[model samples]
Target: MKQKELQIGNLTLRRPIFQGGMGVGVSLGGLAGAVAAAGGAGAISAAQIGFREPDFDTNTVEANLRAMGKELQKARGRAEGGVVGFNIMVAMQHYADYVKQAVKLGADFIVSGAGLPVDLPEYAAGSNVKLAPIVSTEKSAGVILKYWARKFERVPDFLVIEGPKAGGHLGFTGEQLTSFDEAAYGEEVKRIIAKVREYEARFQKKIPVVLGGGISGMEKAARAFALGADAIQAATRFVTTEECDADPRYKQAYLDAREEDILLIKSPVGLPGRAIRNVFADRVMSGERIAPERCRGCIKGCRPTEIPYCITEALIRAVKGDRENGLLFCGADAWKAERIETVQQVVDDLLG
Candidate 1:
């Protein structure tokens, strides 16, 4: 039989798959809970999840805090005692606050990225929540593991290797993304896995490594497993699922996209991101300045005046059915979505 279980610490995931957290109201309670109940590790994105709350414009931080609890409660209710996690970006303002809150709410895992989550263990200290960091290169993997081992005397429960083809803010540079080579990245993943082993030896524990980015189907997943991955993480594949929280229009964007429609653009948060070719992306590429009316203050270093457009607004629009004006972030293979399926269907198709 194929190895179909992912073990970390005392937890065993029957599906050996992670529903990569897609945000801006994309993967929330419905999709996450559905995937978890289907025997996979379901994840929710904690980025501006409160934008739907009425007071988000006025009390942004408070709105988000409330939403964190609200969504987790909903997910827990729907999960049917299955495992559920959150994807909280390290670039968000009050980053550690979200981590601490998620743990308090009984979130089983917290997957962090968009920056080196060096101090994640600080916030998750004394909690039952497992911590994992997203890294795309061996250097980053080594730095993060070495830092955690020395400072907290802890290692990641698992590692998420996000390759270049993933959506939203990526971990690679523009130069690196354009010249992306699959074989080279496979080698990089192996190197990153080696770094994880070094820390695993130091801590005397098993640290599973998961491969992410453009892995949309079984073929790619099998390749990762062959390369020694304990499991795989995927976000774009879930976007078109019926249980996904994003508006139907957002899901349509994935169904309507072409392979050539995927483009790399700079996020105001100071990183390169992958998105579909739409009016919003075109405007950004054409240097049309879409100024922000007010700062919701999401990311830490984002200066309202410095960025061309308000990322929060664009994403908010994306999730609320404003397709033409919103940023549709997706993996390079998003065009492969034929129709919206159930969350269970997606998990079954990927891992069955």
Candidate 2:
């Protein structure tokens, strides 16, 4: 089967693949730019993106906003004007600011998830920058599309459906993830596409649906396309790529991982996450409370003193190569990575 181009609003990608955004330096300007240059859409994560900034420790918001601009510029520099955007999570504090900043930076699009981004259109008002919300189920898709239409009189330019096998903060509950059925989820994907079509008909526009989660290679990508997905998003596959912003050790973790090494873990932000089993994860699973020495003020409504651990710190460590202590968030297919490759190579292999 020949691969088709992915059109999100006015932007056209040569490949129907999106490099899923990974936070805390995992997928930064380098990786995003490479993917975009490879003819796929590239997404830079906005989760504490300024951890490397000089003032990040003291002035969190300002530093992050500054870094966001710099990262976008870097991605654009490497992208050669390819489709580059930011993946800003709604669960983070100052979500509106991030959206506005990305728009002001001339981002091609913005993909918001980790929560229903009901206020996304409002935040991105008066801009041509495409807006998309990530949903994990048909019900969530319905709620978002309905609410957006009733309130904003608009629908998303595209929709990203992240399934249970996705890494990091998943949208499913532990029970749901445990009881997940692929066939049922495939049906759900069809229903979500139907929901999008309803909005498309009402608004007289096209809305592309992107399927993500457990998309390891060509087989998985074919399955997603067969399920009516206009595009497929894969983060784990990108992690092992040479262009990935993560440290070499981070990539090694994925290569060395076995099927049983990846497990579902609880995050401090009231969400279940998937990650490679490590000492830090094991400790958390053993009921050990790893308190945050100082707060990064990343998550919304998160009280540092009450949370089990600081996600920002853990992820930063992971990206920097401290495998023993870092939270190595990864998809179920993380174990399938055998070697590091280039962004173009991975994109070609998956889309072919």
Candidate 3:
């Protein structure tokens, strides 16, 4: 099969594979740059992107923004001007700040999700950086498009359709995620594509659509392309790559996992997320006693009293290499990855 290039605004990706953004220092300089260098779109997760810098937690917003700029510049240098972007979650405490930081850092694009990015266009005005939103359903896409159209009179440069099987904090409930019909999503994809096309026609430009979540291999990528996707975004497969920013032990966990080990677990952020079953998850599920300490206040609507544990602390521990205490977010087939490989090899396999 011949590979097709994906064009998003002024940026052109030779490979239709996009390395899905993972947060808290997972997809930073090494992995993101390597993927971009290999002709794929490399996205840096801006969720706590300043964690690598000293005094990251206590720094002011401007200082943290500077740190993000430095890291993004490092990635740009590594990619030699390849496509590089930042993934900023709308649900994050400082979403607008991060978006402005990414733009100031010369990011080629910005992908926002986890909530409706209704105000994204306002922040992106006068910037060349392409804007994209991750949507799970056609209704969600319509809402964002309508808001952007009415408020900013602008449409997204591209769109990413995330499915139920994606890693990290999911948009669907545990029951819906497990029971939702995959066949039904096909129609949903077509419907969203039609909505995007409506704007594309109005604007007289092409708006590429990328499908994300649980897309691991060329076969799946092909299916997505056939179903109206111009590209596919993958995250878990990148975790096992040599250039991944995650700790070696974290990669090993994915390699050592089995199909059964990947399950949908309750998130402290008031969402159901898919993660690898570990001791932490077991303890939480078994009604074991757990307490929420000082609230980081990361998510907007978190109920510390009712939630079992703090998500920020758990993910921070995982990124810091404390495997036993961290929540390892992964796709549905995370257990299928049996070994570690280079970023290029992973891209090649997906492009094959």
lDDT of 2 by residue, 77-187 (tens): 997869999999999999899999999999999999999999999999999999999999889999999999999999999999999999999999999999999999999
The C-alpha lDDT values of all candidates are 0.89, 0.93, 0.85
Clashing pairs in 2: none
TM-score of 3: 0.96
By TM-score, the better pick of 1 and 2 is: 2
In model 1, which regions exceed 4 Å deviation? none
Local accuracy of candidate 1 as per-residue lDDT tens digits, 218-286: 788888888888888889999998889999988998899988998998898769999999999999999
For candidate 1, the lDDT comes to 0.89
Clash pairs detected, candidate 1: none
> What TM-score goes with each of the models?
0.98, 0.99, 0.96
Candidate closer to the true structure by lDDT (higher is better), 2 or 3: 2
- Quality of model 3 by C-alpha lDDT: 0.85
Q: Give one digit per residue, the lDDT tens place, for model 3 in 1-352.
A: 5577877867889888788999877898788999999899999988777666676656635545776777787788889968989988999887888898888778888999989888888887799999999999999999998888888888899899999889998888777887978789888889999999999898788889999888888888788888899988999999998999999988988998999898888876667888888898889789764676556556778787887887777887888787878889999989889888998898888877
